[model samples]
Target: MSHSIEITPIDDQCPLLHQTKKDNIEEAGKINGQYTNKSANHIIDEKLKDLDKYTSKKFIAIFKVNVGLRKSNPDAYTPMLISIGPYHKKNPQLGSMEKYKLMYLRRFLQRKRGLDVEHCITEIEKLKGIALKCYDDIENLDNDIVDKFSEILLLDGCFVVEFIRECSGMKPNREDKIISTNCMINLVLRDLLLLENQLPFFVLTKLQYMTKEVDEVPITKLVKETFFSILPKMAHASYLEREGDVKCIKHLLQLVHMSSHPSYYNSLWHVQDLSLKIISKDQDYQTWHANMPNVTELCEAGVRFSKVGNTYSDLEDRTTLFDIKFENGRMRMPCFEVDDVTETLLRNLIAYEQQTCDVLPKHFSDFAVFMDYLID
Candidate 1:
């Protein structure tokens, strides 16, 4: 097994030491104190350089300590070998869907081999006790702040339901598979109440961009400028299939549609950093994405999801094995078929699409002419 410096009987305890050592991150924070816009970029750049130096130094120190420890006791390193690969997140953007789906499948199977969907899906459920304050606030009334809290609920809930619905029907080869990233992401969002406090906007921003960056850049800062507030509204569209929620969904969408977003593109620093990522991680990603066979490449990595017991058969007829509240409020099957649900949902969506088509032409003569041409 490979050895490192951090394992040596150090002056610090391992876990606490690990956390303490992490204070010297390779990624830099935004420099405090005001500066002109031009100077801000340069300042950010210099800080990033310093952060990288600190991170490298820490890595060297840790390596030296670990190598010394392995020489002392090789048995200790074995546990670490089992912990290989990233536990949280490794990269920023979720790469090509095909590769991610395959990777997800592999991980799932490895983690939960031979587990049926019923047993596998159980971890996603069960009580993880709520924030008592957040829970209590929801139980009894606060008339004055009810509107604000309600607004948050509407935003958060809508984002989740729609994301699930939109992603509920993914499969490989069909070009209509569930996005594994979306599923994992949504679960993480739900588990926030279970795991952490209600995720603040900045934390949410960090989670999106928190993949280890090339120069040890913490994405949370960039995420501050990168996020679209209206992103929360996409959830409303998803739960449209659920009953009695149509008007609420429409109102949420209307707010999103009317909103203006902050100019985040300027804060982005892709000029060099993005390239560093592309050169590094993209090679592995490109290799995986390119490996797809033309025939089966586009499907949900053939559903052979390692962890979730998903197979092409599992995804057959477009079904996924989510413990979802079906449109009728009953629990959908542990492994429900997708095509049946989509045909029904798509029919309603298409009908709505037609109504939209009918109405949009009144405001746009070009649209009216285009509709006429299509009918002709």
Candidate 2:
């Protein structure tokens, strides 16, 4: 006969386990916390007092990209020409653009012929709490936090507003550096849309309202004009204006994502189940859940592909980037033109969709997965 002996678990507070808070308590005492006997629960509560700041909904929008995702391609998410917001404000490489920010700020102040710079600064200061809460990694910044953050928002916000206004129609000075050069304009446009290079949209709106011309056009109108001028020819101003004005734009990238959202997908797919059933020539029950046949396989099976016309006014009520339809052995898709910045645009968009998946439907992610399935 054999007997089993049960092993008892050791306490988390046991000194032998080397998990007790004694050392921490001694360190705290050395820092002048005075002597006291604190329970484990109390200690843990103290340590996690600021936990809710991170978990709150107010702070959920902006975040650093996941390490796994960033490691895949750091350059895709990093800003190239100029940095915006607190995350990249300290990068030495972007220092060259700082002078332009101040220049724009001076121009913005001078535009209204008595626009108080202090008034703009005070307004940005009021938003410090809300702005700080939007960023997840802002706490990592070193000293002079208040002044540094306020200055960043003030400078970057003014620069973006002025840049957009100039791009829209405001004639720049004859010697304007960025606006005069097409190459620099394109680079700055790309930089503004990076995931890590962003400021909360409200900040921009506030600055625009504070310094807008007496009969200034709507900010949305200005944004569309600027984006339309630089966006790829395939996806022009009409494409970005599909959804009209969005009510809850988080940032520039999010604005672009919203504008590029496919209305066709919105009408057909179910959010609860992110899969759709597509009837193939061989099978009627084929869903996106399975390993679907590739494009070549479908073509070999007697499927014909055609490019849909770009003008959506004649076809449907709305235009979409991912407009594809299959019927009567024919697959019709909207023409997509790939340029140099296309990959960077799509990568940042996919990153945004992945990060905000909890609050946002995975439009770009679904499109990417579908494209992968078709190509692979």
Candidate 3:
């Protein structure tokens, strides 16, 4: 006799599964290095010294951002978390995020052998100032891609694109923040915001100090050229942005994801400088795409968009992203597939961030309880 039985799937809505709404801030925080490690600072300083032999100011932002993320009271929706990359633990069961967080936090806040601890006060001060400023800018932070793009533009010749590809891939917590290829992408972009301009100097100092950190030839040479260059362009880019030249603004914003070498960066730059020159008007990509069938690769990074109450004016010329573009009088968009850990965290952060931005007085009792439990 043969028997057939049906296998029942777990319901996401089941309370036993806790559903996604049960905010796990404490758990996430615990993984994000919320615990105290007494000897943490000394080890961090040593790590910083070792890294400095390879690069200067490299660990500054690494530490600054690392500490910023660490020091941030999780109550603020400013919960943009960062830590070691997915590759850190080949096996999750054997590897512990707790140890990783301890080291990561220590590295950011300590000063060891390589540092002229007495004379290094000024350099540390500079990092603190910039980091504090960024925190202040949080309220004014534009969620639109253009601001990010424009910020990149203020740097030299697609250098950010080059630098990011080289440095990124960190996560604070091991257990829940799911690692993916996209995480790598965000890692590069976010870190670039901190270390982009300083990359070239960082490279030279790093190479002289630690010869075997990585082995990429052309990338090394290119970094040398960019670090030495890029200063003059910042002035011109600043001028264009202040004028609200939509084309120039959008073009620069797109550059965050591009570089002088990348085709996308080249394509986007061409569209911004020469394309408008040819069109003889402040025409956006919407007007250009109507006549041109192909989308330039560069424009992908900077995009024109409208959300709730804001307009990314710099991204005006990017035209609607093809996904959001219309075809044959119909519209299409990627399915918002839920049920992933990162996606869930992103949604949670987005919702919390939105609430904070929208109201001065926001509730955090539940969030606090959740976060406290995780850290405790």
Top-TM-score candidate index: 2
Order of candidate numbers by lDDT, starting with the best:
2, 3, 1
For each candidate, C-alpha RMSD in Å? 28.5, 6.4, 22.7
Across 178-251, the per-residue lDDT of candidate 1 in tens digits comes to 34464454333222211111222321222222222244332222221122211221122222212332222221
Candidate 3 per-residue lDDT over residues 1-376, each given as its tens digit: 9999986675532333234344564444345564334346666878877753342232222211233432443322121232121111133442343343334323322223353323333433333323322221222234442223322221221233223223332222242223235664353233222311122233222222222224434333333232212111122222222222222211111222112121122232223223333333577746653332222322342323222211221212222111122233222222222332323233222233232333222112222222233234
- Count steric clashes of candidate 2: 0
lDDT of 3 at 43: 62
Off by over 4 Å in 3: 1-99, 104-122, 137-322, 342-376
Model 2 misplacement above 4 A: 1-42, 53-55, 172-178, 229-247, 263-287, 310-319, 358-360
- Of candidates 3 and 1, the better by TM-score: 3
lDDT of model 3, residue 168: 33
Span of ten consecutive residues with least summed lDDT in model 2: 269-278
Alpha-carbon shift of residue 256 in model 2 (angstroms): 1.7
If scored against the real structure, what TM-score would every candidate get? 0.16, 0.79, 0.23
Candidate 1 off by > 4 Å: 1-127, 131-133, 136-170, 175-261, 264-376
Which order, best to worst by TM-score?
2, 3, 1
